[model samples]
Target chain A: AQSVTQLDSQVPVFEEAPVELRCNYSSSVSVYLFWYVQYPNQGLQLLLKYLSGSTLVESINGFEAEFNKSQTSFHLRKPSVHISDTAEYFCAVSRPGGYQKVTFGTGTKLQVIP
Target chain B: EAGVAQSPRYKIIEKRQSVAFWCNPISGHATLYWYQQILGQGPKLLIQFQNNGVVDDSQLPKDRFSAERLKGVDSTLKIQPAKLEDSAVYLCASSLVDSGHNEQFFGPGTRLTVL
Candidate 1:
């Protein structure tokens, strides 16, 4: 069984400030990691994912996350944030084998103040 | 391509009443999923279907909640005798079958309020 934990429930940042959302998971087998963003009243949109190859993954919107296997962490980061970046972020993990059910963390709400 | 579609964007029903929600996945996708998202929480998978066959429904509250993906296309979810705790957003997502990368396209969820 796999479970995801997002350490922060809320994070407030001033415009142009850097921010990081911490996420950790527990799994006994290989898994796929993903980050999703949900804007107000909208469905979740994929931000990025880490399947294999590089441990670091990036999104077009200047957001990035690094998958740390040893630490069992997949933290999302952005060097600078804009007011438009305020939204909810979620971390999810899926098992490697068939019947891959993705389990998500209790999201982190990002508030970017102008 | 058109994204997933869901009907009755918002629903309010009294406890012990029944409600149903509909979903249509992206064209040609063979994998569809139903999830429940409570306020301040991430989406939790309720059930999954592969080409109209049940795949996983481990977390679904079987006694009150049921779902089906008929003909490997449109799907419907129902809750009978709803509990107040079941008030949450129900999300539907779809993905291409056998795709190495499980990138799911989601629909704007149906928000259910159990009064």
Candidate 2:
């Protein structure tokens, strides 16, 4: 069994400011990590994923996350944020194989203030 | 091309009532999943299907919940006697296959409110 823990329940960042949403996981076996975003009234969308590759993974929208095996963490970060970046973010963990279900954290609400 | 599709964007019912949600996955997707998203909580997997066969359903409340994916393309989740705690958003997601490289795409979700 795997569980994800999101440190922050909500984050308020000024437009064009930097932000980071912390995520940690507990699992005995190897795992894959993912970040998903959900805008208001929308479904969850893939933001970025960390499989077996470099420690860092990035999304096209200027968001990135680093997989830290030692820390058991995969924190999502962005150098700058736009008003449109306001959304709920989730951190998930999945087994590194086929037909595995991803377990998600409670989620963090990012509020980009102008 | 198209993302996952779910029906009846919203449903309101009383306790002990029966409710069902429909979902149509993306074309050619071989994996489907049903999740429940409670307020202020993350989505929890209720059932997962791999081309009409059950892959994982350990978390599903089988005594009251049932789901099926006929033809492996579309799926339905039903609750025979809904409880107040069942009031949440029901989401459907699909992946080409549950491979390492593939990702799950989600639908808009059906918000169910039990009164």
Docking class of 2: medium
lDDT of 2 by residue, A1-114 (tens): 899999899999999999999999999999989999999889999999988879999999999999999999999999999999999999999987777789999999999999
Q: Residue A79 CA error for candidate 2 (Å)?
A: 0.7
TM-score of 1: 0.97
For each of the candidates, what fraction of the native contacts does it recover?
0.51, 0.66
Error of 1 at B69 (Å): 1.2
lDDT tens readout by residue for model 1, B26-107: 9999999999999888899999999999998989999999999888899999999899999999999999873435898899
lDDT digits (tens) for residues B1-115 of candidate 2: 8888999899999999999999999999999999999999999999999999999999999999999999888999999899999999999999888864468899999999999
> Pick by TM-score: which candidate is best?
2
RMSD of 2: 0.9
| Residue A20 displacement (Å), model 1 | 0.4
Name the regions of candidate 1 deviating beyond 4 angstroms. Answer: B98-100
